[model samples]
Target: MRANSKEQIIEAAGVVFERYGFKKTTMDDIAYAAGKGKSSLYYYFKNKEEVFEAVVAHEAEHLVNEINASINVSKPAVEKLRSYVNIRMKRFVQRGNLATALNDNFLATFSFIEKIRNNYRDIEIDMIGEIIKEGIEKNEFKPVDTNFIAEAILTCMIGFEVPLLTKSNATDESVEKINNVIDMFFYGICT
Candidate 1:
């Protein structure tokens, strides 16, 4: 079926792209990985760029789903926020393709990346804003601008990612640092 073949190609392409990265990967590479001829790839995707975009979108969607699944709605807002950050950071380090997509150099080279980044930001903002709103409604958190706080938390997380990416491995120290920062966010330093 056309749908199955297309999904097969995207799935294969994700592996190739993860291995070779976008700049080094070619149509032949993806086609070979997919166990199809190069022409078959052309039928489904206009070019390598389109294929790469699909791969990035696919991986991102997977991560978002994982994050959403890990959040327990019955839990307190603080725990929900903590769980979201822990799972997000842990997975970001674990998923090679995702790390590549978020890499600054990869982002700078692809025009399509801007749209993906913006879409991701919108999703994060909405998710975090909802949690913050819920916290306020339950009197767990002080009243504040939910959108602004959510945006700030998103910004902080992005800042955290840079340090994690630089290291050859994500050390426990790094994760501990993240936990400490999150703790600071939830409970101020003065106390």
Candidate 2:
């Protein structure tokens, strides 16, 4: 089946952005990659930023879909939480470059980019909150403020991104760290 023009543009843009980094990628490069003229590209995306935004959104959607699938698999809340964190961290590590680029200070300055980032975060937190709520309902986890706990869990994951995504630490070590966190989350550090 033939891909639609916008899908084709977004796919080409992802390749260009991944290869060149956001700062160096140009609209012409994406247009060329997509085998479309500049005017045709403009018809779908007003600028490189717009194209990049679409690419980021596309990537975010993919991540969310994966997380949702993982969550849907039969498991208790504790197991779901562990699976969620493991899957999320693993995916982030796989997309380390893109994740780092999105978190860059310069990119943070763009309102559109910031909005996209915020939207992705909110969706993730909501998903996590659902898992926590389920755990509580099932009596597998102690009752807590779902929103607060979800946000906190996500914050901790974000904090680990530097080392986890950068490969500053070994992948097994990072996974161990996540497991440790999940353990502490389910059972307090107190002896």
Q: Which one wins on TM-score?
A: 2
Residue 173, candidate 1: alpha-carbon lDDT: 63
Q: By TM-score, how accurate is candidate 2?
A: 0.93
Highest lDDT scorer:
2
lDDT of 1 by residue, 1-191 (tens): 99999899999999998788788999999999999999999997899988988887888888788878867458888888888888777766665666677765756678887777788889989888888888899998989888998898888888778777676386456667766876776677995
Please give the lDDT score at residue 142 for candidate 1: 86
lDDT of 2 by residue, 60-176 (tens): 888778878888988888888888888888878776334744577777877887788788889989999999999889898888999999998888888888787679447778877
Regions more than 4 Å wrong, model 2: 1-3, 96-98
Candidate 2 weakest lDDT stretch, 10 residues? 94-103
lDDT values for all models: 0.81, 0.82
Clashes of 2: 0
